[model samples]
Target: MRWMQRTWIGSTITLALTMLFLTGCPKRPDVVETVPRPMAPQGEVGMPTPPPLPKVAIPEEKSPTEVAAQPSEAKPTTEAGAVPEAKIAEAEVKPEPSAEGKAAAEPELALKDIYFDYDQSAIREDSKKQLNENIEWLRKNLAGKVTIEGHCDERGSSEYNLALGERRARATRDYLTAAGIGADRISTISFGKERPFALGHDESAWKWNRRAHFTPSAK
Candidate 1:
């Protein structure tokens, strides 16, 4: 009976130790559930794909009509067939006259005027020489008619001066006619003291005012 009681006590102590160890020790944590990530589809797999092509561009085809319609570039030719640049420049340059041509341009005859003396009663002898030269020019030209315009010194009444001017003009016309100019080719007019060549009442002014002037008129 003692042995059995000892065995029973020992069993009871082991059972109590086991119960204590289980109560004091902590339990391990539970593992959480996880979902796997989806994978990317590969090109060689059951995926849709684009059509394959060559890397280089294909030459476009042209119709025969379009090719024939295009203009061709001009071909370079020799100087014999084409005008030279030097020739073109020469054409653009103007011709310069020779020295002989310039010398020949001098005038043969020139128009000249005559001056009279101060308030003279008649034309002076010096004026006769000038009138002779004028007659020579008239005979040479032979195309134009002449008119003698007589003027008086600004000293007398206008009406009296006008009559005096007319006499002077007629005298000049008679002289021209005697000098071999045709009477039909000459005419006369008179302007009195009312139209003075110079305004000052001086010798110099009177010389300019008392004059018979000649002007050529076309037929």
Candidate 2:
């Protein structure tokens, strides 16, 4: 009986020691997870570039020579910018004449007469009507040109007579213009008692000298 109890106690003690050793032992480490790196592009090894900017329009400047090459806008004018309407009308339209009328109308100008003033003067009143008639005749006949030659009585100095003769001629020309004669066809010169129609030292000679003679220029 004593030997039997001793053997059972020994078996119980060994079982207890085995249980204690299993409770005190360390545990094993778990698995660690890892992520993979991204791969590079096939052709290029850098980042993508941005798109290029759009093109812009720029204006060009005109040179001075180019500006001058442009056409001008101003119009030309006649002499002194004065256009004579009556002269233009006369040139544009002409009147036909009969046979006798043509013979009479053929440009024939003559001084044919002498005008007189009181002694030592160049004033006349009736001469205006005659000068107007002569101018009208010249305009109607379409005479190409006419000249007025002025003279003075042999009483004043030669220079004074020449000046006075010019004054008379100018007065006659102005009257003719007022009577509707074209000034373009009429001209004036001064003889100043140099060319006398009558050969005498009397009133008749002075009368002839103090006149304005008309002469037609050959057409």
Candidate 3:
């Protein structure tokens, strides 16, 4: 009976030691579940892809340079009928021929006036020099035609002075026609006791009024 009691006691102690060993060791921590990260798109099975790159521009190769034209060598502008620039420049610079055998420019007056005595239609000796000068001027301007105006002082009857003025104009015309001026190129008019020059009633005014005046005739 004592050997059984001892065997029972040994079994109880062995069970108590196993329970203490299991309680004495530290406990393992609780396992945590991790969230998955976002990923780039897959091109194939495993590799991820980026955005496409822009196209690159390549420069073209240049052609070889040709020989330049010389300075003296001018190119043709038109067909064979066209005149060259050099010839045109020459024509522009070339001087023209002047009028042959022409005299110098005409004098400003071309012809001069002649004075006469009161109540006389005769040409005076002093008046001869001026009359010759008028003839020379008329000859120079061959295209020129003239009219002789006979003016008189405010004296005598108007009718009498008009007759005298006509006589004076005719006498002057006769002198010019005889001196080689054309008869057709000469004309005579009488303004008797009218168109006085000096404006007073003296001999000085009368001498200037009684004269032959010349003017260019209209064509």
| Candidate 3 error regions (>4 Å) | 1-108
Which digits, one per residue and each the tens of the lDDT, describe model 3 over residues 35-142? 796674668567657778898898765554423332457775687788878899998997754433122342435556677787899988888788898888889789
For candidate 2, write residues 1-219 as lDDT tens digits: 989899999888999898888778865668676667665555455845556689787777799999899999978656786768888899889887676676466545323333657333343777766766686677667756777777787787888888877877777777777777788887988888777777788886776778877777652
Give the local distance difference test score of model 2. Answer: 0.71
Each model's lDDT comes to: 0.73, 0.71, 0.80
Candidate 2, clashing residue pairs?
none
Candidate 1 off by > 4 Å:
1-121
Q: Tell how far residue 119 is off in model 2, in angstroms.
A: 7.7
Q: Give stretches of model 2 more than 4 Å off.
A: 1-106, 109-123
Ordered by TM-score, highest first, the candidates read 3, 1, 2
| lDDT tens digits by residue: candidate 1, 83-104 | 8888889999968766556433
TM-scores for the candidates = 0.47, 0.46, 0.50
Clashing residue pairs found in predicted model 1: none
Q: Deviation in angstroms for 153 in model 3?
A: 0.8
Best of the candidates, lDDT = 3
Could you tell me which residue pairs clash in candidate 3? none
